[model samples]
Target: MNGTGRIQVARKVVGVGSVGTRAWVLLMDTLNGVEPLFLQAKEAQPSVLAEYCGRSQYANQGERVVTGQHLMQAQSDIFLGWTRARGDDGVDRDSYLRQLRDWKFSAPIEQMIPEGMTFYARMCGWTLARAHARSGDRVALAAYLGGSNAFDEAIADFAETYADQNERDYAAFQAAVDDGTAQATTEI
Candidate 1:
């Protein structure tokens, strides 16, 4: 809210990691409703790694999330911010906000053949490594990893197992739907 604007609507939204969280898409406009900006306000709870990594240093979870994103990304969203609000459950919640969507090119992952897919995977791997390195965890993690391919192999095995689980979960869901135990609709 760097300038004058009015909120148009606040629509509830949810996704994979945000299930049961108070998340919303805030629609707003300025200049007599000619320009519209959609912001996604997602509740920031304790990090999933908190049990193992301990709590974040920042007092506000939203601020911690925003700070981590800033540290991790080379080009973060200009609208990235954080705030506190009273949730529908009458509880105070911290949330991180950012542009709902930003323009950028995405690889044609589905269209890639096996060789292309391998290249894309390596590209993605390097990008993630670069981000982690930039975030100042490079030295400690590198020292812990030492000089071996065991960690790499373990990660690869874990990824394959995770993908296999996802397939099985989707198949079970489809089976449940087919048996009338569950329902699904594509018309969302």
Candidate 2:
């Protein structure tokens, strides 16, 4: 995995000022061990973004790995497929939240974080929505996040319910396992 490379395709449609610059830098650092293929939209100071993305340093052994994302989604899909084949487990909610925390400080401009913050909230909401759809538990996910709002209402509801049920399920399972009433192939 260390030798693997990541191709990052990002758009500056929202804006390329300090926020965009910071995002580019963080993406580069986060993927340090791997080869980086970067593609910046032409609308966002194309020349400057290209220069930064393609910069070569002596420390990198003169390897210029960054490239444009002309192919965009196709390239992204291929790279994702390759990563999946390499046994990289997809990011889960916990890991996603951690990444958000890291991005907050690493971002180029702190004030440009409102949108980014919303992204995390939306993710949480989506996860909770899915869980609710599956378990038919209206308040399960919402309780986890505390309150109901456009950002993470669904998750908060689902989490609240899930916690209640999960507690009961876990207690029963643990008692059964301890008493040898439940057969198991391994200990959790």
lDDT of 1 by residue, 24-93 (tens): 8888889577988898898899898999999889888999999999999999999999999887679899
Cα lDDT, model 2, residue 154? 61
- Residue-level lDDT of model 2, residues 93-153, one tens digit each, is 1100012122222334456578887776677566545644554454664555555475556
* Residue-level error in angstroms, candidate 1, position 175: 6.1
lDDT of 2 at 100: 16
TM-score of 1: 0.78
Cα distance off (Å), candidate 1, residue 13: 2.1
Q: Candidate 2 — worst ten consecutive residues by lDDT sum? A: 92-101
Q: Rate the local accuracy (lDDT) of all candidates.
A: 0.89, 0.40
